[model samples]
Target: MKKLINNPNHVVEEMIDGYAKAHPQHVRVLSENSRSIVTARETADGKVGVLIGGGSGHEPAFMGYVGPGMADGVAVGNIFASPPPDPILEATKAIDKGAGVIYVYGNYAGDLMNFGMAAELAELEADIQVGKVIVTDDVASAPKEEKEKRRGIAGEFFVTKVAGAASEKGYSLEDVVRVANKANDQTRTMGVGLSPCSLPQTGKPSFELEENEMEIGLGHHGEPGIEKGDLQPADQVADRLVHDILADMPLGEGEKVAVLVNGLGSTTKMELYIVFRRVEQILNEKGIQIHRSFVGDYSTSLEMGGCSVTLIKLDDELTEFVDAPADCPMYVQR
Candidate 1:
């Protein structure tokens, strides 16, 4: 209940205004739609447009990824709520440059419905061709055979990065969609929750956890995880998450991967690095090469105290795209 925000209802709007003001060099709110944000940089006429979005609270996402070599536009929604179709369509229109547009977002139900509606509107009313890649990377959410039903988590960063790089490289909408799907297919994530977070509006915790208890495989929006047990050491937690991920998608000896140890919200960097140390040890023992490592709060769920580990098995094509230069407000790569 203790938060630094004013007026729970106005948090989303105030957040957008502040973010745009702070990073005006990289992004701006859409003139016609306050819920949409677009890149401040000019885009090429024939290049494919990349648009990403989701609910708010996961900062530096959706909106933070709008810039050169990243998403060209974003349709932001309220906290943990999918945006309506109008802003999505507006963002689509604003970024479309005659070639086509590609949408990248999580595989949540609300997101699918809203984005689908926006795509139809773009095609029918705006005369713009649109494609989409839904991210399904949380292994704990569904079985391998039912991955399509899984929820997207931190692995969204990898999917969005690949989509943006492909679009920036002038890939057609279909190709962009293809590579994005490939990235999602190669990615897997598993999370552990040590505590719960509260919503500004209700001022109540989403879920409760005993002081010494933890939930394994928890979702970002407080969805129930698979198991609950007494808290264990960081290495044991890392082992459990990595074990599940590797079991779902086994990596061959000498295979390369991009590792992301992401904080849910309030988890400290020191704790994350300790977890990463164990992760690195596990992967190295398995002979899986770590091509790139990103350890921080890439995706979060308010101030929830937990972390998720994401691994994207990499091939040459995926490696190339992942290494492409990108400049955005929260995420930048060279």
Candidate 2:
């Protein structure tokens, strides 16, 4: 594949190295491992610790949210792969403040397996308390009766962000898990992909789509999309995606929403904004006020072309937590 890197195996290490160099005051890369923690300061003596991890391709994720109002540590894996148990345990130990640590991530099988194993090992090996929240926001993963079985998508961001903020606010591990689970319950997401991405190591695109084609319900790992359709206008595409998500959530009128229009790597800002306009209009028509909005590449799938829409119906607590100030290299809030 045409990757702008020195080596596939070294990509995570080198990228984290540069990330540490670029944001030393905010965070520090472990140097010898893919795990990262908040820069030496910002730890509480008896407060809860927060950690998140998953595959690598979905950047500004798993790790990117570690900062003042987010995660204390992040264990990362290979591209589209779960971080091994060692790093996961390392992250838990590194961030454990005396109270305990909370593990938060998506519900991907690989992520669940690795993180679960790590939690068990941490307890048996080190006597740590680590609870987890698996974000499952994709309606396309399972039947309506089995929505909890679906795969997670961009909504994982809201879960991670809100949950991390809760921990930073000194919530208990169980309470943080509850907050994350509640956010996941109120959130839903849908996506469209315009083209394929080449995995740096594989030297091949993960999937293929002809020009003027579009994929619906595509997950981050280049999973098969729900359906292939002809390219449509940004507004129309937004309608299809948002409507489907809302229908699944059955979100009614008068609720407040925090909308996320995320670029899946190669998507442009103009297209995202065009789609955002439609989303805003639709929610407005439904009498759902748009209180907060994130329109950018919060999470990416290598260099794939497309975007995803995430909507979280918010309550007072969730809104305040999301609005809380945060400073990270990629996503910054004030």
Candidate 3:
């Protein structure tokens, strides 16, 4: 509630405006369409244009990845809300190259509905080919039988990175989708909620938990979690996250992985790193080397105080694309 925002209704617009101004060399925000497209300066003609879309609030997500080596366009919505079909369709049209386009977004109901509609609309009119990869990595979101039913967390980053890179490397639309789906299949995540986020419009906390309690596997919308319990130490929390995520996607001690310890807003980098140290040590004991690692706010739930850990077992091709340079205001590790 103590956010430094201008107004709830205008936050998304204002933020997008500022973002476009500060990173002109990389991207341009389409205010009318509620989307942002990467500068054609970096993406070559006849190459597949990669597009990703989702709600706002999760910074460095649907938008920040649009750059030289990442997404070509992104559709934005209100905080914690899905972008409309118009913007999604516009994004597809804006980014489509002669090769085609791939639409990669997290697995969420609203996003599914909106993006699906947009894709249908685009294919009906334009000569644009589009495919979608739904990121379902949060183990806490559903049981094994319903993994696809789970919501996406921070694992969207790896999906976008690999998928975008595949397209940038001149992969076909189907090929880009194949690699993106592979990235989704090879990833899993788990997280805990220390505090809840407030919807910009409502100006009220989405949910409330006691100071001594934490919710496991909570959705970005602050939905009820898999379980609630008394808060534990950071290491213990990390153990819960690691064991749960790794159990589903078992990591043999000698294997390798690219880890992402992400903050869901309000959770400082200090806490994220505290969790990462334990995660690193645990994976190291298992003989798993980190091919690439990121620790900071990636996808956030507005100002929720929580974190999610993502582990993607890396392969040669994936490693190469992940290492490709990406320049955005939020994730500028080129």
Candidate 4:
């Protein structure tokens, strides 16, 4: 359990603190709640305020997306843990303008509970109207017929990107929610785990795997997946992942889509590129058109080693929103 930190309990605080300082020009901790962060730019008048929140650990996620044309605010929790209602409320309040607020987050039990409570609190006390779009895009977490039961993973990037673009377009809260929900529906993701990550506090791997073994369809928080098997060649691994996602939602000929090859944590660019190489080849063979491609460590699970692939089916409307300009620490679109 090797980690660079003064105290395991203080990792979240220190990380957030350092993030605020490092990107002061683009973000700041809410004065009312340290756990909540808001875009440095003042909330745009009459624009739907976008608030994305969830557990901490997955950096460049819930908070890193805070900036113009992205999330207006974010409520952060402990590593792989949901934040309480208070900070969620603070985040909602910080972003809400007369146009109302939209909450974009993964479809997790804790997030649903806490965000639901915060929405009720905001309506009750501040008279702020709130809308929500919960992302459930991991295909391996559930059967195709049970997508709603799947857990959100790297696909969250596409969901947030579309939602933020809609908000920037001055869509009403209802419309923004609609757009984000549509993105979630069009998105599908699948991940494989080559190694496990240790919680800062636990100082131990959350799960164990034998040497030269891999877990397909593993969740970022170590959720069980389809199966575990001996580590295979990169192309074989990529083929299986791409095949599962395509089977769940067939892309068909000439359909355009966005591709996101994300590193879970310690996976290197070289490995990710190797995976993407196969992904591109597979898509080309299927006659699916790649509208855009993104590759990097957009979402991570502490120091875990593995990666996930996300694809978002796109139409003219979705394509425009995805290409819209956004400025954030982790995501930038010009």
TM-score of 2: 0.96
Q: State the lDDT of candidate 3 residue by residue for 1-334, as single tens digits.
A: 7777887789898988888888877777665575554553546778888888788888877778787677888888777778888887877777777777888887888989998888889889896777888899989988988888988888999898898778778888888888889889989989899998888777899998998999988887787888899999999999999999888998786677899999988998999999999998888878888888899988888889999999998878788877888766567666
- The TM-scores of all predictions, comma-separated, are 0.99, 0.96, 0.96, 0.99
Better of 1 and 2 by TM-score: 1
The Cα local distance difference test for each model comes to: 0.93, 0.84, 0.83, 0.91
Relative to the true structure, candidate 1 reaches a TM of 0.99
Model 4, C-alpha of 102: deviation from truth (Å) = 0.7
- Using alpha carbons, what is the TM-score of model 3? 0.96
Off by over 4 Å in 3: 40-42
- lDDT tens string, model 1, 163-233? 99998888988899999999999999999999998899998887889989999999999999999999999
**Model 3 clash number:** 1
Better of 1 and 2 by lDDT: 1
RMSD, candidate 4, Å:
0.8
Q: What is candidate 4's local distance difference test score?
A: 0.91
Ranking by lDDT: 1, 4, 2, 3
For model 1, the superposed segments whose C-alpha errors exceed 4 Å read: none
lDDT string for model 2 (1-334, tens) is 5778997878877777787888878887665455654545668776677788888887888668887777788887888888888888887777788788888778777888888999999889889998888888887667678877888888888988888788778888888889989999998889999988888777798888888899998878788878898999988899999988987887777888899999998899998999999999999888888989999998889888999999998999899888988877777898
Best by lDDT: 1
